[model samples]
Target chain A: MKRTVPLVITFIVGLVLIAAMFIPHWPFTGLDSKFSIFYDVIAVFAFILGGGNLLKVHLSRIQNRRRDWKYSIVTVSGFFLMLGAGLLKIGVPGGWTGDYQADGSLLKYLYDATFQPLQATMFSLLAFFVASASYRAFRAKTKEATILLLAAFVILLRPTPLGYYLTFWLPKPLQFLHIPNLSTWIMSVPNMAGQRAIMIGIALGIVSASLRLILGIERSYLGTEGKD
Target chain B: MAEEEKLTIIERLGAVDRRYVFLLIAIAVIIPLVLHYATSIPTSEIVQSLFDKIESLPGGSRILISFDYGPSTVPENQPMANAVTRHALEKSHRIYLMALWPTGSRQSQQLIDEIIKVEFPDKVYGVDWIHLGYKAGNQGLINTLLSDFKGMYTTDMSGKPIDSFPMMKDIRTLRDFDLIIGLGSGFPGTKEWIQFAGDPGDIPVGGGTTAVMAPLLYPYYPKQMVGFMGGLQGAAEYEYALVKKYPKYAKRSRIASTTMGPQVTAHLVIVAFIILGNITYLLERRRKRKYR
Candidate 1:
């Protein structure tokens, strides 16, 4: 009964949403918008559940003294710090009438001074890792590897002065062979074609997978379908 | 001499600690950046198309600028957002800013603070621009906003009702906007904008995206998307175009140009390492063949 009830709900909702897209008459005219609002409202509420789970998991870890429990303390402390800052409107100028994210708020300070830099620094670490990984990957071991190596070499130089400086003197008629021009072509043509194929494949996969879910053939999302 | 008694350059290259590579990259990137090095970028056709579109837009035309990225991609997306916003402001277009990602709203606010308020202090808030903050439905938000903007955004970023903003008076749906500039990085980003809002509303869309995600978006350009800026290189090209035409900005802040120094330096370092690795591999292969 538990499984059937959710399955029926899914099928009905999925079919109706699909139908609404095509019909667009009477109640269905603004049905997508209504459903979207419903989703937004639900998501906002779901945050409590999500936050609760997070607290439960982290608190349990700290209580049990799990491996790396010290990190959990930091996590819990940071979460509560930001949450308290935001919820209490602590240090917000002009009292509660103003925006929580407004200037002079502790939340704003934490976000701008701490969160933004941390995120940017985290993302910037990719440069080092990518440089290290690519050095190892771009070796000429096989025919395909040789092609990739050559392509990587050209592309690496393409966006910078090295590519332009190396090939800027090329004849106008042979401009297509220029490193920058070649790089553009490679990205726009072959890369685009490959991307389109992948997108289309992904779309089809989604449709198929969605159908499996709607028909209740793909109940794995409900947790126990795989075992069954 | 026995192979066991001596080490080849290839073996040595292979044995070099990854930290050394990381350090080399750091030096290559940082020194050039600190020195404010730059190589001028010739605007490519794709970027030129975008520049032309913005240039040709009639004054007072509304441009919906969506920042569907987060702080993680700030290195790539921020410069493009700054340049694109500046170009729109220069054209005297009304900017309707919004965000799909949660972090996008914050990024949008940062842009407005950094560029709009500082550079174009004369521009009015409600009339010249309005920030719609962010919506939570991701692609679902786009689907609704395409047909009905008010259905999604009832209030501006500042919590004022949408009707209160003079600039938002005429905008009823995403279709009302003359163009969409989706500055994004990953899923629920440029791709989602193109699929949901741009395609459905037939709005001309251009994107500023991270380098890694750029190639995936190319297939949509010229047809669905007008043009796109990918990574620091794309941002640099747009900045060059902007300054070349409006030389006043030439003396102004140069985010992408300053960063391009490190970008170019890092690329060279990586390429040199790649070449050395290849040379070592080939030499070792030859040795193994000769032994066999």
Candidate 2:
């Protein structure tokens, strides 16, 4: 009965939200927004679940003296410190009445000195990873590989003054063969087509997933996997 | 010598070192970036289409600009956001900035301060446009706003009620906005805007996304999305269109187009490496077959 009740609620809410999209009546149109507020209320409670899970996992790790348990210490410490800073508004001169980062707030100091640099450093790692991934994946062995290789070449060549220098002598009519022009075509036509196809697939996937959840076909997220 | 001679092109292709490809891509990206600041690449059609959408909107039209990205995508997304905001301001469109992501509120604040406040000093806060601030619950927030915007968002980021603002008084739902411009890097971005807001409400929407995500949105162009700007290239294109219309903005900002030089060069380098790797693979395959 417990499982069935929630399933019924899901089915009813999901269909209503879907119907709200097409129907423009008083209650129907407002249903999406009302559901949104309802979700927010649920999410607020869910945060407690997440927090409890985090505390449990880390506490267990520390108690067991697990390998790399020290990292958990750092994680827990940072989490609590930030939590306190946010909750108490430490060093915020206006006693929580003013902006959280008024003048000497800990948040401002942490954000500027520690968080900003850490975030930037993490983002910078993408450059190296992109290089590494491209090196490993961009081998040309087949027809598709060859095409990708050539397209990549044009795209790279077209963006620089050097590309112009390299292909400068081509006749005006053959200027379409210019690297920049060719690269534009590749991105707009082939790249756009591929992206659109993937997007459509993803859209359909989301719909299927949402429907499954709504219909109670997927209940793993509800924490009673076999009951459904 | 006979065995070596018998090795085919396909066989030799297999033995290419990956490091060389990495080095080439690095060079490709770096060189173009260095050159981009010195010169500019021509804009593309997709970007022009995005520009036209904003341009065509009547003056004083309400535009809902949702910043649905974070710091990770700021480099790619920030430029597009800035360009779109600038275009709207130039057209005298009232900008209603909101965010689905938490950090997105800060991003929107930066835009308000950096672009609107700094550049268009005459633009008022509540009357012209306002920041609706970040609300959690991702698409759920969007879903609620679709029906009763005032119900969920009673006030602007500041504490004033939506009813207090003259512009917002008439605005009841998502359908009221003339255009919805979503700057998205991932989930709950352009896709969410299209599904929850655009598809259902029959509101015209557009988006700016990272290049990797751009292709996925093409099918929705001129339909769900009025137009889209993809990565740095799209930003550059939009910048180009903006510059053509309002030349002064060209001097002020060229974030997207400026970055295109590196993007193009990097793509080319990857292509070359692929070819080199293929050649080596073919040669290596041929050599192995002869030996067997």
Candidate 3:
């Protein structure tokens, strides 16, 4: 009964939503959106579950004196600090009625001082890593590698002023040889063709997988396998 | 004999320390940034289509802009948001702001502070523009809004009922908007908007995204999407178009174009390193053949 009941519910709901897409009338017209709202309401509760789970795991680590438990202290403390600031609307004007992210609020200050800069710093590291990796990996050792390398040269250089100067000497007749023009053609044609084919393939895969789930053949999501 | 002694200069360069490459890249970025170097930006057809769509719209046409990215993408996405917001307001279009990510609310607030509040102080809130704020549920949220926009969002970002906002009177669902632009970094972003809101509602969808995500969006151009801006370069091109149409903006600080000098310099440095690496590879192969 445990698995059967849930599967039955899923089949009913899935079929209704699928029918909603095609029917678009009366009770079935907005059923998908109604279901979406139900999902959102449930998701809001799931956030509470997720937050509690995070605290539990980290607190357990600290209690057990586990490896790198010290880092958990930072996570746990930061989480609480943000939660308190946001919930209480600390430093926000008009007390509890004010916006949580009002200019003078503690949550606003923390986001600006800690969150924003930390996020930017993490993303900025990608530039250095990309440079180091490209230097080491962009060698033309094979025909495929050479083709990739040449394409990379054009795309990478296309946006730069140096690329413009490099091919500016070409006559108007051969202007298609210009780096920017050539890169655009590559992106709009070859790259787009590849992307479209991949997207179509993914769409078909999703349709099949969704159908399987709707038909009760895909039970892995229910945390059981094989016979279940 | 020392093993290093037998290697040619080119071979040695192929084996050059990555630290040097990092240092050179750092210098390349820092120097241009310090100098405030600027360059002429060329607009692409894809980016121009978005700009044109916004420009062609009549006054009071509602344009919804969703901030579907977080702080990490501020450098790439922020300028796109600002440029579009500025352009839309300049044309007297009504603006509707919303977010898919939690951090997006803060990002939108930044745009409000930096662009709308400061530049277009005469633009009245609730009448000219409104922020619906961040909501959870990702693509599900979009789907919910498609059928019942008001059902999903009862209040503005500041907690006032959206019904009180004059600008929102005509905006019953996704189809009401003249345009929808998603400034996003990843999933539940531009792609989700294209699928759930744009295609289903038959609304024009466009966006700006990080460079790494740009390739994925190209296939949608001129069809599923009106057009889009990709990365910092894309933002710079849009900014150039903005300035070209309205010369008054030329005097203001353009973030993307200013940042391009460093970005371009770094690209050149990486290109030089790649060339050096390839030269070293070819040289080593020749040496091996000669020894054989």
Candidate 4:
């Protein structure tokens, strides 16, 4: 009964939503929006579950003195500090009714001082890694690799002034050979074609998957080991 | 040590430690930034189309700009958001701000405080512009918005009822907006808007995205999307276009254009490394054949 009930529910909801897409009537017209709101409300509760799970796992790791457990201290402390600062409205200008992230609030300060800078620092580190990786990976071993290498050079230089200066001496008739022009052609033609093809395939996959789920054939998502 | 000494220069170059490469890149990026170096970046047609759309819009044309990015992408996405907002306001467009990601709400507030309130002091809140804040649903939020805006957003970010705002009076659904600009770095962003709202409602969508995610969006341009700014480069191009059109903004701090100097230097450094690596590879290959 437990398994059947969920399967029956999924089938009904899925079919109803699908019907709602085309019907556009009283019952079906706004059904999607209603379901969306329900999903969002449920998601809020799910966030609480997620937060509890995060604390449980991290606290257990610290308590058990697991490997590299010190990192858990940072994680747990950051979580609690931000939570307390926000919920308690610490240092808020308008007091209890004040915006949690209003100026002069502890939450806003934490976000600006610690959160923003840390996020920027982490993202900026990608440049160094990209530099190192390109040197080692961008090799011209085969004909395709050589073609790829040339394309990479053109794209890498396209946004810079050097891309303009490099082909400046070329005749007016051959201006299409310019790095910027060539880069645009490459992206618009071959790159876009490939992307479109992949998107079509993905759409097809989504349709098939939806059918499976709607028909209750996709029971693996129910954590039933995909069994009947 | 003795065996290492016997290796040729090409072999040594090929095997150079990655740490040295990282140091060179850092030096390349820092030199331009510290020197306040600047340059002219030619605006591309894709970026120009977005600028033109805003330019061509009549005064009080409702434009919905969604901030779907977060703090990590502030450097890339923020400039695009700021530039688009400034352009929209300059044309007297009624702006509606919302967010898909949770952090996006803060990002929107930052834009409002730093750019809107500071620069366009005459622009009234809840009339000229309003922030609907971030909603929990991803694509589902968009799906709902396609049919109803008030269904998802009952109040503005500050808790004032959305119906109380003059701008919210005419905005019944996503279709009410003349244009939709989605600034996002990843999923549930520009793509979701295109799929769930723009395409279905036939609304013109345009926005900026990170360079890495730009290619995925090209197929939708000029059709599903009006036009889009790809990345830091796209942002720079848009900034340049803005300066060319409005000379008053020429002296203002154009973050994207200024950052281009460092971007150019870093790209050159990467290009140089590629050349060096390839040259060493060819030399080593020739030597191997000769010895064989």
Over the true interface residues, superposed, what is the Cα RMSD of model 4? 1.3
Error of 4 at B189 (Å): 0.9
Each prediction's whole-model lDDT (CA): 0.85, 0.77, 0.90, 0.88
Tens digits of lDDT, candidate 3, B195-266: 998998899999999998999988888889999999999999999999999989886639899888898888
Error of 2 at A164 (Å): 5.5
- Ranked by lDDT from best down, the candidates are 3, 4, 1, 2
TM-score of every model versus the real structure: 0.96, 0.86, 0.96, 0.96
Q: How many residue pairs clash in each candidate?
A: 0, 33, 0, 0
Order of candidate numbers by DockQ, starting with the best: 3, 4, 1, 2
Candidates 3 and 4 compared: the better one by DockQ is: 3
Off by over 4 Å in 3: A225-228, B1-12
Minimal lDDT window, size 10, model 2 chain A = A94-103
Off by over 4 Å in 4: A225-228, B1-7
Relative to the unseen true structure, what is the C-alpha lDDT of residue B108 in candidate 3, on a scale of 0 to 100?
A: 92
Recovered fraction of real interface contacts per model: 0.65, 0.50, 0.79, 0.66
lDDT of 1 by residue, A38-92 (tens): 7766766677788889999999999999999999999889989999999998988
lDDT of 2 by residue, B1-292 (tens): 7655545433433444546555666777677676664345566766777788888889999999999987777878888889888888878898899998876876787787788889989988888878888877788888778877887788777556778888898898899999998999888899889988899789998999986777677777766788888877677777777787788887788766666666655655555555555556566666568779
Candidate 1: which pairs clash? none
- Candidate 1: lDDT of B167? 83
